[model samples]
Structure formats: C-alpha cells, structure tokens
Target chain A: MKLLELSGIGKRFGGLNALTDVSLHIGRGEIYGLIGPNGAGKTTLFNVITGLYQPDSGEFNFNGKRYRAAKPHVLAGAGIARTFQNIRLFANLTALENVMIGRHVRTRSGVMGSIMNSRAMRLEEKACRDKAGELLNLVGLKKPHQTLAKNLSYGEQRRLEIARALAMEPLLLALDEPAAGMNATETENLKELIEGIRNAGITVLLIEHDVKLIMGLCDRVAVLDYGRKIAEGVPDEVRNDPQVISAYLGVDGE
Target chain B: MPNAHEAGIFKRQRRRILLAAILLVLPFAVDGILGRGWLRIVDFAMLYIMLALGLNIVVGYAGLLDLGYIAFFAVGAYCYALSASPHLALAFPQLFPDGVHLSFLIVLPAAALLAGGMGVLLGAPTLKLRGDYLAIVTLGFGEIIRIFMNNLNAPVNLTNGPQGISRIDPISIAGLSLNATQRIFGITLPSVHLYFYLFLCFAGLVVFVSQRLEKSRIGRAWMAIREDEIAASAMGINTRNLKLLAFAMGAASGGISGTLFAGFQGFVSPESFSLMESVMVLCMVVLGGMGHIYGVILGGLLLALLPELLRHSVLPMQQALFGKTIIDPESLRMLLFGIALILVMLYRPAGLWPSRVRRRELSSDERPDETA
Candidate 1:
C-alpha cells in the first residue's frame, strides 16, 4: 500500500515554476528515489512534501490520512521526518542531545510537565536517551557524550543526521542529498544505510546526486527534468527511458 | 565505578548543605559587619537573579533577543501596585470605597499571569523577526510600555503617570507582615532581613525550575530552536508555540520580580522600567554565561552588587590615596563597569563560563585544518 501519495502537486515562485503537476506514490518499506538534473525542483518537491512550502495545487495523502500538513512540525508529528541537504544538526548540542531533540515529536511533555520533573517524565526522558543512544550506534557514531554535533567528521555528520531523523520513529523518512559530499566508500556506506532503513520497515524518500547509489538502492525511481517528471519506473527502466535520456543528455545525443 | 559515582553524589549533597548554611546566615552576617543597607542590595540581587534566569529562557536557550523584558517587570509592578494599593480605590472609588487591597497571595500569581499574557501579546507580532531586528522591536516595546505608563494619567490615571504609584502594600504571607520588624526568641528580625529570606526562597524556586527546564524535553527543543529554527520545526518542535512559551515564561519571571520590587520599594515608577534596566538584565544573562544557571547567578550577583560596592570603595580609596575627592565616584563606577564588560566579552566571547557544548563549538573551528 502507498504510504505517501501526491497528485497534481504544483509550486510556483513568482514567475518561476518550481514544480508542476508532480505526482508520486511511495509504498511502505520501499526506498523511493527522486532524481533530477539541476533546477529540476527536486528539493522543491521535497520541501512541498515536508510542508516547508504550501503547494499551489495538490492532493496530499499520507498513511491513509488526508491533510495539508499546515506546518513542518505537524508533518513531523504525523510520522513524516526529513533532513536538510546541508545537514542542519544542532551544532552546539551533543550528538545524543541532537537525537534526543528529534524524539521531541514523539514525546508529549510541555513546559509544566518538564518543570515538575515527575516520575513519568524522568522515565520517558531516560527511555528517550537510551533510544537516542541506540540510534547513534545504528548509525555507527560513538562517544556521543563527549562530541558535539559540530565537532563530528563530515561523513559522521551525515550519519548523525540520519540517526537524528530516525529518532522520530517515522513511518517515512525524507532525506535530501544525504550522500552529497561523500567519497566512494562513504557513498557505499550510505547506500547500505539507506537499505538498512528500508529493511527496518520504514519508507524512505531520497534525493541524491549520487546516481549510482540511487540506482543501486532504490526499489523504484522517478526522473524529473525542468520541474516535470520525464519518467517513472524501476531503476533499470528509468535509467534507459528515452525521455529521461533526452532530459539528462539532450535530444541531439550529446 | 559505582563507588566513585556514589562519592560524587555524596560530594554534591555536602556542597548543597554548605551553600544552604551560608544563605541562612548571609543577611545577619551582612547586618553585623556592613549594615542593613547591604542586605537591601542582596535582596535586589536575588530579584535580578530571577530576572536573569527568566531572560535566559528566551534569549539564551531559545535564541530570541528580547530588549523589552523590563516591560513585563513593569506590568507586574503595576499589577501589584494597582491591586493591593489605594490607587484603584481613588480612581474608581465607586467600585472600591476602600482600596482593593487584595491579599499578597492572590496578587503575586495574578501579576505573573498578567505578565505572561503581555508576553504573548509581544511575541505574536515579533514571531517573524529575529536577531537584531527582534532586539529593535523588543526595545520599542519596552519604550512603549514606559511611555504608556508616563502618559496614562491624562486618560485614566491607571498607572498614576509620571508621578508613579506609591504606598503599595508589602508582602504578607499568612498574615505575617514582612514590612514590620518583629522580635522572636530575642533575635530582632529587621524588615531587610525578612525580605532577604523571602527573596532567597523565591530565588531558590526559580533556580530549581530553571535547572529543571534546562535538561528536559522543552529545554532541548528550545536549544534546538536556538540552534536552527527550521531544523527544530522539522524535528517536530512547534517553533511558534515554543518561542511564545519562552517569552511567556521569561515574562512571568519578570512579572514576579516586578511585583516583589513594587512591594520592596513601596513605589512603582516608569523610570525604573527604562531601556537601561533591560540592557542591564541582558548583560547579566550574557556575562554570566548565557545558558548556564550558576553563571547567570554569578553574573546577576556581581552586576547588582558591583555598583554599590564601587560606591563604597571608589571615593574611600581616593581619600586614602590622594587625601581628596577628585574624580566623581558614580562616573568612575560606570566607567569601570563598562571597561570590565568589554574586557570580559573580548576574552571570553562564548561567555565567562560557557556551557560545555558551546566551548566545543567555539574551539572546533581550528579542527578542520587538522582533519584536512
């Protein structure tokens, strides 16, 4: 069954059409890939899906529920979590604290409840900390107590972002260019991590410039060029579609 | 390992007891050595600590710059003054033949709630602004409140205008009037000493709440917002509500402090809630190390007492050295205070005592070279 379905989604920025008539259905437990050339509105589509931008026109349905997702936090609360392209980790917070913050959407404690420091809040907080630690280990990050998010290595920062995203226990995780600045080995590790995320029963929506990683990991891929989907199919079919080839290469066969 | 952990807990408990003992004797000690005037300064220090801790929740934890924080203080002061004093009775004598002198118990929480409501009013319009822009708007808000207090006399005399509100009732818990000196067990308890204990208890409660907030989910979410607002929202933190909550919380503290101030000083004036007072409170939060509780307390105590300490020392020192009063003591105090602030910021950009995570962030800049 489709975990997230979008139909006729359109976003406009003044005179520029960022995304037009974009529609895709992401099934549960599938690593869905969204690939495009520069200025293809890949990130814009991600933003619209994540509720950062209000869609000029669209029908958004997630997990059998229909809603506009009015705000990013609302989308997050509804089990849709996302990470930024440039890795927006809380720089001054520790690795554990970063992930613990991600657990905020799942946890329900307000100012008074926290200030009261009730037995239940303490237990919830401890459980959150333990869960955050487990997620860090899953992402291969150690010494979370000692290291700030800003002090982590580039590759480790990417993994930490993934851990932070996972801390929400999201049904669907949207990642924007998770492998943006990685070497070959790092990309390989990221590919495996994405697959691991899919195997964990969470749907994955990924936008990456690493074409090989996308082709290797995604269950199905959709290709967009100039804010329009040129092709949508399994990896091999999308890789060979004539329209997609023309969009990526040019009709003149350059 | 367990034994070491137990030892750590034991040490912490012992330190807590030692600190408590010091607090218990602090007023009497000051009274015996320096005089009752110093105890008043100490009382004011406790109030500043509450103000600093409140502002820290907004500016330090949530990274929202609020320069109009004094407005909330003013709101609280006026709330207490109008409610417990004869101002209401004189203005609307039909409604209150005798002044509406409500119990202190009712006024304190009422004032805090009023301040919190005003905080929401301030926060709603300024949600889109941030950084220096937020500061500018908040600065305007502070001035606006003071100007209103100054001019409201013509329209309603609600705040008594520039003349201010006087003869406000002192705090009395369970009919035990703190305003009057009482003799118990042949130990004379001065009004200043009574106020010190009351203020200390309230300060301790503020510290406890602040510390509790700094570690919980709300505090983490606030820090997340401070770090990156968009990321925080994406992480499922409702940035709008959280930001407003921080403001309200901070304003509530300011309100409580203001209520106490109005009672302590026996008057409420527009001049007391000036832009300068807001900046002074912000300085305490910044200089004390923004996010650290103890650092803020240290900052509050030092700033509150520094001016008076300078008053006592600068003129006397000049007399001892040159045998004459040459440089003005007040001006010299301000000059020294300014210089000290600049030097501390220059040396410790993060803070005088920064949070551990912040220290790592400041020092991590040099690491890229090593990694490369």
Candidate 2:
C-alpha cells in the first residue's frame, strides 16, 4: 500500500512558482529519493509536506488519511517526522534533551500534570529520556547524554537530528540533505544509519544533491527541474533519463 | 555513578531546594528580629520578582520586547481599587447607586482576567509588528492607559483622576482580615508583615509556574521562537498564538501583582505606573537571564531591593561626607542604577544568571561552516 501520496501540489512565493503540479508516491517501507538542482523546489516540497507552508493546490494522503494544513506539532503527532538540510537541532539543549523534545508529542502528561510532577508524568519523562539515550546510541554518538548538542561535530549533529526525529516514533521519516557537509567517511556512516532506519520498518523520503549517495541508497528516484517532476523510476533509469542528464548531471559533469 | 554530570545535577537541585526553603522562612525571621521596615522592603522585592518573571516570558523566552508592561500593572491596581473600594459607588453613582463592592477573592481573579483581556487586545494588532515597532506601540498603549486614568477622573470621577484611589481595603481570608489590626498566631501583626507573607506566597507561585512552563512544550516553543521564528515555524510551532500567549500570560502576572500592590499600599495613581517602572522590571529580567526562572527572581530581588537599600544608606553617608544632607540621595541612587545597567549590558549581556539554554547557545561553537 502507498504509505504517502501527494497529488497536484502547487506552491508560489509572490510571482515565483517555486513548485507546480508536483506529485509523487512512496510505498510502505520504501526509500524514495527526491533529486533536483538548486531552486528546483525540493526544499519547498519538503516544506509543504511537513506543514511549514500550505500548498496553493494539493492533496496529500499520509497513512490513508487526507492531510490538512496542520501545524508542525500536529504533523508530528500524526507520525510524520523530518530533519532539515541545515541541521536545526535545539542548540542550547543537551543531546538527550534535543531528542526528548521529539518525544513530547507522545507524552501523555498535560501541562497541569507536568507542573505537579505527577507519578505518570515522571514515569513517562523517564521513559522518554531512556528512548532519547537509545536513539543517541543508535546514531553512534559517543558523547555523554548530558553533552550539549551544539558541542558535537558536524556529522554528529546530523546524526543527532535524525535521532531527534526518530524519538517521535515516526512511521515515515524525511531527511533533507543529511550528508550535505559531511566527508566521505561521514556520508558512508550516514548511509548505514539510513539503512538501519529502513530496517526498523520506517519508510524514508530523502532529498540530496549528491547523486552517488542517492543512487546507492534510494529504491526509487524522482527527478525534478524548474519546479516540476521530469522523470521518476529506479536509480539506473533516472541516471539514464535524457532530461535528468540535460538539466542536472550535464552541469555537474562540466 | 560519581560522574561530573550527575554531581552537577545533584548539586544544582540541592542548592535550589535550600534556597527555596530559606526564602520561605525569611519573613518570620525579619518580623522577629529586624522590624516592619525590613519586611516592607522584602514585600516590595517579592512583588518586583512577580513582575520580572512575567516580563521574562515576553522578553526573554518569547523574544518580544514589551516596553509598556506596566500598563497591565495599572490595570490590576485600578481593577482592585474599583472593585474593593466604597468609592466605586461615589465615582460611578449611576452604575451602582446603592454601591457595589466585591470580596477580595473575586477582585484577584477579576484583575487578572481584565488585564489578560487587555494584553490580548494590545497584542492582536501589535504581534505582527517586530522589534522597535512593537516596543513603540506598547509604549504608546501604556502612556495612553495612564493618561486615560488621569483624565477619566474629571467627568465621571472613575479613577478619581490625578488624585488616584486611596484607602483601598486590605484582603480578608476566612473571617480574618489582613488590615492593620489583624493578628496571627500569638503576635499582633502589622499589615506590612501580613502583606510580606502574602507577596512571598504569590512570588513563590509565580516562580513555580514559570519554572515548570520553561521546561514544558510551550516553553520549548517559546525558546524555539526566540532563537529563530522562521525555523520555529518550520518546526510546526504556531508562532502567532505562542506570541499572544506570552503577552497574555505576562499581562496576567502584571495584573495579579498590581492587585497586591494596591492592597499593600492602599493607593493607586498614574505616577506609580510609569515607563520607568516598566524599564525597571525589564532590567530585572535582562539583568538576571531571559529564560531562567531562578535568575529572573534573583534579578528582580536585587534590582528592586538595591535602590531602596542605597537610598537608605546613601543619604546618611552623604550627610557625614558633606556635614549636611545637601544632595538628594534618590538622584544619586538613580545615577548608580544607570551606571550598573550600562555595565551589565556591556559586560554580561546575557544577564547575571543566564538561562542554561541561553548560556549554552552563547558558549557553544557548533555552527556548520557554509564556506567549507
């Protein structure tokens, strides 16, 4: 079954059509790749999907329900989690606290319960903290749980962002340029991490400028140019597509 | 584990609990040993703490500069005065010919609600305006409220105009009144001591709520907004609602404190709720730390108490230095305050007690290099 589907998504910023008639689908537990040149509306699409921006015209179905223009927390509560290309972790929070914030949606304690430090709230907080620690461990962050997130290395910060999103217990995870600034070794580690996430039964949607990484990790690739999807298929088919080559690969090759 | 992290957390918690215990017991010791003057100062300091904590929600956590927070304070004071005083019948003779007065309990909530309503009214249009625009708008709103209070006395005698409201009744609880004649336990307590304990309780409640909110989802959303509104919005936080909530909640606190202030002093006037009062509260929040609850409380206490203490000491010292009290110590006190604020801004902009999050943000070097 389709885990996520977008139909007739259109977005505009002033006179600029950042995205128009962009539509895509991902099967359950599949790693779907979105590849486009800069200003090709990949991030804009991500923004619309994550509820940061309401599309001008579109219908999105996630987990078999028609998605509305919900707030980020509402989207998070609905089991959709995402990471930013620029790594937007809560810098002042500890690594564990950063991940724990993601767990806040699942927490049953209301404001009153938290203020009173009720038994259930305390138990839930402890559980959330444990889960946060586990996510940090999964991401191969060797630092103490109390270590501030902003003190981490570049690769670790990216990993921490993923861990934070994972703490929300997402059914589908969106990673935007997870390996943007990483070295080869870091990118390879990220590939392993992405594979592990997929192994844990979560569907993955990724946007990357790195063609090699996209080809290696994605099950299916969707190519976008000038705010429209031009081609989509398996990695080999996307690589061979003439339009994809002319618009994106041609510029990179020169 | 005997690790440094665990040790730090343990030590911090211990210190916090200890400090809270000391503050709780402080009123009793002051009443027993020092007398009413010391207790009066402490009461005033506690009131300032409540105001500071509220302002911190707007300025520190939510990153909205409010230069007219004292308007809410005035609202609270006036609300209490209007409700509790017999003069309500005198001023609004048409509204209540037989005279209408509410119990102190009702007045408290009424003040808070009225002030919160005003906050939303002010925030609705102004929330979209950022930075200096917000500051100026709030300043205008505050002055307008004060001027309106001053002028309203002419036609209707509502706020008693520039003369202000006086002889406002003290709070009463369960058959016992907190008037000058009230006694507690075995000791015959003055109203100042009664108010000192009452303000202490109110300050404690504010601190507790502020601390809890800072660690909750709402708190996180506010902090996120403060760090970067665009990014916070992208994270799915409703920035508009959160900003409004901050303003309303901060206004609510001001209202509560204003009620207490009117009851404690038995008077309300336009001069009492000035721009300088708003700046003083803002200084308390900024001087302590924006988001840190404990820091805000400490900031409030120090800022409120220091000037009063200086006024007491400086005049006597000036008398000794010049052989006559030629210089008014209040002016010198203000000069020292201005100098202190400048130093704090230049040397410790994050405040004397910075919030843990703010401290980490300032100290950490984790920004990804785009050039690299």
Candidate 3:
C-alpha cells in the first residue's frame, strides 16, 4: 500500500512557478528517490511535502488518510520528519540536547511538572536522555554526545542532524540532499545508514544530486525538470530511457 | 565500571550541591568579615542577579530582545506600592475602606501577576516584528510607560508624577511586621541587613527555578527557538506560545524583584525605571553568559557591585598615585568602564561566565580562537 501519495501537487512563489503538476507515490518501507538538476524544484517538493510551504494545489494522503499539512510542526507530529539540505542543528546545544529537543513531541511532562521537578518529570527526562544517547550510539556518535553540534566534524554534524530527526520516531523520513557535501567515503557510509533506516521499517523519500547514489539506493526513481516530472520508473528502465539520457547528458550529448 | 553518562551526571550533581552551599555561606562570611557596607553591595548585586536571570529567559533562551524589561519592574513596584501604601486610601478609597491595606504576602504575588499581564500585552503586538524592528518597538513601549508615569499627576494622581511614592510598608510575615524598629529573635538588626537577607532569598529562588527550567523540555524548546525559529516550529514545538511564555515568566521575575526593591527602599519613582536600567540588565545577561544561569549571577554581581566599589576606592587610590584626584571620580570611572567593555567584547565576547553550551559554541571549530 502507498504510505504517502501526492496527487497533482503544484506550488508558486509569486510569479515563479517553483513546482507544478507533480504526482508521486511512495510505498511503505520503500526508498523513493527524487533527482533533478539545479533549480529543478526538488527542494520545493520536499518543502511542500514536509509542510514548510503549502502547495498551491495538491492532495497529500498519508496512511490512507486524505489531509494537508499546513505547518512543519504538524507534519512532525503526524510522524513525518526531515533533514535540511544544509545542516541546521542547534549550534549551542549539545548533540544529546539536540536529539532531546526532537523528542519533545513525544514528551508528556508540561511546564509545571518541570518547574516543580516532579518524580514523574525526572523519569521522563531520564528516559528522553537515554533515548537520545541510544540514537547517538546508533549513529556512531556516542562518545561525542556531550559535544556541541557546531563543534563536531562536518560529516558528524550531518549524522547528528539525522540522529535528531530519528529521535522524532517518524514513520517516513525525508532527506534533502543528505550527500551534498560528503566525500566518497562519507557518501558510502550514508548509503549504508539510509539502507539501515529502510531496514528498520521506515519509508524513505530522498532528494539528491548524486545520481549514482540515488540509482544505487532507491527502489524507484522520479525525475523532475522545470517544475514537472519528466520521467518516473524503475532505476534500470529510467536510466536507459532516451528522454532521461538526453535530459541528463544534454540534447547534443555534450 | 560506571559508564561516562553516570559519572557525568554524578559529577554535575555534586558540583551543583557544592556551589549552592558556597553561595549560602559566603554572604554571612562577607557580612562578618567585610562589615555592613559591603553587605549592602552584596544585596544590590543579588537584586541585579535576579533581574539578569529573568532577562536571560527572554533574550538568551527565547531569542527575543526586550528593551522594555524595566517597565515590568515598574509595574511590579507600582503594584506593591499601590496595595501597601497609605496613598491607596487616597486614590481608591472604595477598595481599602479600612485604611492603607494588603499584607506583604498578598502584594508580592499580585505584583508578579500584574507585571505578567503587562508582559502579555506588550508581547501580543510586538510578536509580529523581528530583530531590530522588535527592539525599536519595545524601546518605544518603554518610553511610553515612563512618560505616562511622569505626566499622570492630575485628576487621579496614581503614581505621584515624579514626586514619587514613599513611606511604603515593610514586609510582614504572619503577624510579625519587619519594620525598621522591629527586633527579630531578640536581636535588633538594621533595615539594610534585613533587606540584604530578603534579596538574598529572592536571588536564590530565581537561580533555583531558572536552573530547573534550563534542564526541562520548555528550556530545550526555548533554546531551539533561539537556535532556529523556523526549524523549532517545524519540530512540533509551538514557537509563538513558547516565546510569549518566556516573556511573561521573565517579566514575572522582574516584578518579584521590583516588589522586593520597593519594600526594601520604602520608595519608588518613575526615574528608577528608565532605558538605562534596561540596558544595564541586558549588559548583565550578555556579560555573564546568555544561557547559563550561574554565569548571569556572576555577571550581575560584577556589573552591579564593581561600579559602587570603584566609586568608593578609585578616588582614594588615584589621589595616592597622582597626589590629587586625576579626574572627577564619577566621570573617570564611567570612562574606564566604557573602555573595559570594549576590551571585553574584543577579547572575551562569550563573557566571563559562559554557559557550557555557549562556551562550546564559541570555542568550536566554527568560531575564531579567543580567551572568552
């Protein structure tokens, strides 16, 4: 069954038609890849899906329920979590604290409980901290949990962002250009991490410029150009299609 | 063997307990060894510490720059003064028909509520503006409150219109009045010592609550908003409500301190709540360390007490060196202060007592190397 389905999604920023008539289906536990050149509206599509921007026209269905996510927080609460193209971890907060913040949606203690330092509140805090530490460990960042996010190496910061999002325990994870700044070794490591997340029964929707990574990792690939989907199929068929080849390598085979 | 996490938590708790013990005993030692005058300085330092911690919630945690913080202090003072003073009978005879009314117990919480309500009022409109625009709007709001207090002399004469409110009553506990002539436990103590102890208690409470909040979910939300509002909102945190809560809570603390100030001084005026008061409080937060509660306490003590200490000693020391006071001590002191602040910003931008989080951020690979 389709876990996330976008039908006729359209978006406009003033006069700019950032995305138009985009439709895609993401199956449960499938790794869906979105690929396009610069300004292909890949990020725009992610923004609309993650509820950072409301699509001008579209119906989004999640878990067989027809609904529109109007705000990012609403989407997060609805079990949809995402990482940005540029790492946006809270710089002053420790890695554990950053992940703990992601656990806020799941936390039951309120302001009064915290102020009074109730026993239940202490237990909740301990659990959250423990869960955050586990996530850091899963991401191979256990030793650096107390280090500030900004203090980590570039690759570690990226992993920390993923750890923070995973703390939300989302059903579907959307990653925007996760491999954008990575070296070859880091890219290989990220491929394994993405596969591990998929194996853990979470669906993945990823936008990437690395066609090689996308083709290698995605169960299905959707190609976009000038705010429209130009091709959509299995990786083998999509890679061999004449239109896909021409669009990627250019019409004159430059 | 104990893991890193357990060891870290154990160490932190032990350090906190030790710190609390030192704070509690240090004041009494200073009073015993340094005398009453120095104790007065400590009292003032404690008061500023409370104000800085309050302001830290708004600016440091929530990332909202409030220039009208002193207005909440003014609101608190007025709330306490109106309820406890003989002037209440003159203004609102119907409310207090018997005479000047309200026990200290009632006035304290009332002052906090009144200031918190004002905070909501201020936050509601300015919430739409961000950055410099918000700062300007709050500055204007502050001036409006000050001007209203300055001009409202005729007809009702609520705030006394620059003549100020005086002869306010001291705090009374259960039937025991803490008046100037009152003796506590058979020992006759000066009013300054009484006030010093009161402020010390207030400061301790502020530190305790702020420390707790810093470790809680709300504190994390505030820090998230500070780090990235857009991302925080996306993380299922109600950014707007949380921001307002920070403002209200910060204002409430300011109100409590203002009540203590009014009771301690037995007088208050419009001039006391000015733009300079707001800037001084901001300096305390910035110089101490934004997110760190203890850093703010340090900032508060240094900024509030250093000037008074200099005023007393600098003149004599300069005379000894130059065979005459080189300058009118007040002007020279301010000049030195300005230069010192510039140097501090250049050399130690993270402040004297940066929070662990902020210290890491400032010292991380992303930042330039500096002693701060």
How well does each candidate superpose onto the true structure, as a TM-score? Answer: 0.97, 0.90, 0.90
- Candidate 3 regions exceeding 4 Å error are A64-69, A240-243, A250-254, B1-38, B93-100, B314-326, B360-372
- Which numbered prediction scores highest in lDDT against the true structure? 1
Report residue A14 deviation for candidate 3 (angstroms): 1.8
lDDT of 2 by residue, B248-338 (tens): 8899999999999988888898999889999899989989887788789889989988988888888888788888887687888789999
lDDT of each: 0.90, 0.84, 0.85
Expressed as tens digits, the lDDT of each residue in A61-124 for candidate 1 is 9899987746889999999999899889998888999999999988987778888888889899
- By DockQ rank, best first, the candidates go 1, 3, 2
Stretches of candidate 2 above 4 Å error? A249-254, B1-35, B94-98, B126-133, B230-241, B323-327, B355-372
Better of 2 and 3 by DockQ: 3
Interface RMSD for each predicted structure:
1.8, 3.9, 4.7
Greater-lDDT candidate between 2 and 3: 3
Residues B1-372, model 1: lDDT tens digits:
999999999999999999999999999999999998898999999999999999999999999999999999999999899988888776787998877789888999999999999999999999999899999999999999999999988655688898999999998889889999977679889899999988898788888988999999999999999999999999999999999999999999999999999888889989999999999999999998998888889899999999999889989999999999999978887798899899989988777888776777777766653230
Candidate 3, clashing residue pairs?
Answer: none
